[model samples]
Target: MSEYRAGKAGINAEAQARINSKYNDEIAQETLEWIQKITGSPANTAGDAENLYEVLKDGTLLCHLVNKFQEGSVKKINQSTMAFKCMENINAFLEAVKKLGVPSQETFQTIDLWEKQNLYSVVVCLQSLGRKAGNFGLPSMGPKESERNVREFSEDQLKAGQNVISLQYGSNKGQQSGISFGNRRQI
Candidate 1:
């Protein structure tokens, strides 16, 4: 009877391990799908897998959910208002971090590296989870599109506004004549 009981327990343990593996696999698949959807990038690097695992392991899932909710709420608020609130959250987190007296440089360096790798969404999500776990004062700054130098504008040669100006194209001017503007309307 003892031998039979031992066998049963071993079997149960093995089954449990399999279940855990399957669950992990499902989570990974879901996370990959999410990343692909968000980034519109087809290829997945090993770094992406590791990063996703770290995020889920470190209680960042909660933060992602919180961000989703925040985005939904922002849908109701005007873009400008929502942007202001996001900026406020970022600044508030920064101030709170300083008040907590942690090494600001180290914390910022970690955040900066993650941002440079385009992992700001994950950082934001993880920070949200950290806040809920009584680890408040984490700065949750998402990546700004401006981090990349690429810019977009209407292809039409003619744009008119009080703040708008015209660019005269000459063969003498190469890419330098890219029609630079200042204090121009964002519209």
Candidate 2:
């Protein structure tokens, strides 16, 4: 008899449902459209997470997508059907996107895309890349990238701020509540 797989079906199903719930068809569709527009390649999905995975699993189009932002970002695009080759392509695309200013936190792992474990994370990474694309004057799909607002305070202003007791410091104003915890209710 085969050894019993502990917590296999139940745990896997719950985790799968949780990951599925995080996926947004609309966002996937928008990401697909944006990728198609940028790479000039037609995707074969209807914007669903599964379709999106199929469209990006090979990582070829992703490499092309990053190249659009920075020429030759991914110097070589693999054309092999082997698993490692496909993962290499994904890694190349990820590294290229990182060079293009996509935050490390925003990018998903190779297995996340390869195994289809977390397609939502893939979509989120694409959305983050789309937002970062705006920084390069490209037509972005998601929200525009926020511009850095660096404020330099003068010495006098800094000194003035030090003298002020901000509300965040919790000034009680010498007041105390008459309530107590862990006591029986008083009727």
Candidate 3:
């Protein structure tokens, strides 16, 4: 009897999971249709709708959605006097996040995700989130894209890099300290 009850519980959980998956797939299909309609682009039917969520939640997708909203501003459903509900939802979420004093990073990862994407209202978000940044261990100031430089290490630089790494970690590994080397690039 106990074994039967356990089996039934497992089946119930599996059934619920299937239902959720089906619901999400339906939503993704509807969203794809809306995206096509708004962007006036060819519809995408490449993969399972359920798989679209992973690709649709990035900075690139956010910018594309904003552009679609702008281009499709006049295309409205249900006796429209305003913008699309999708844009409204984003604004609403932004407002809610602002009121909670949450950092903009909580919504988007980097400042580029806002500035390069032209996501206005970031100033307000920064003001609100800045007040609570320290509590969350997040940096108060976001660096610009140009400042994020990727430098190719010279052969000498690589040796120096290894030395610096050795200084920090070699002590733990019972090794001698790193060889002293001068920096060629500014820290």
Best by TM-score: 2
RMSD of each: 21.8, 4.5, 19.3
Score every model by TM-score. Answer: 0.23, 0.82, 0.25
Best by lDDT: 2
Whichever of 2 and 3 has more TM-score, that candidate is 2
Alpha-carbon local distance difference test for all models: 0.37, 0.84, 0.39
lDDT of 3: 0.39
Ranking by TM-score: 2, 3, 1
Over 61-180, each residue of candidate 1 has an lDDT whose tens digit, in order, gives 322333343333222212232434434434433444444433454233223222222233334433333333223222322232123478666646335343454464344545644356
Clashing pairs in 3: none
In order of listing, the candidates' clash counts read 0, 0, 0
Q: Write the per-residue lDDT of candidate 2 for residues 1-187, one digit (tens) a residue.
A: 0124333378788987898799999888888988887888754647887688778888998998898898899899999978799899999998988888889999999989987778888998999999887778788877777878999999999999999988888876776456468765555
Candidates by lDDT, descending order: 2, 3, 1
Give the per-residue lDDT digits (tens) of candidate 3, residues 114-155: 212212223333334434433444333333212346878799
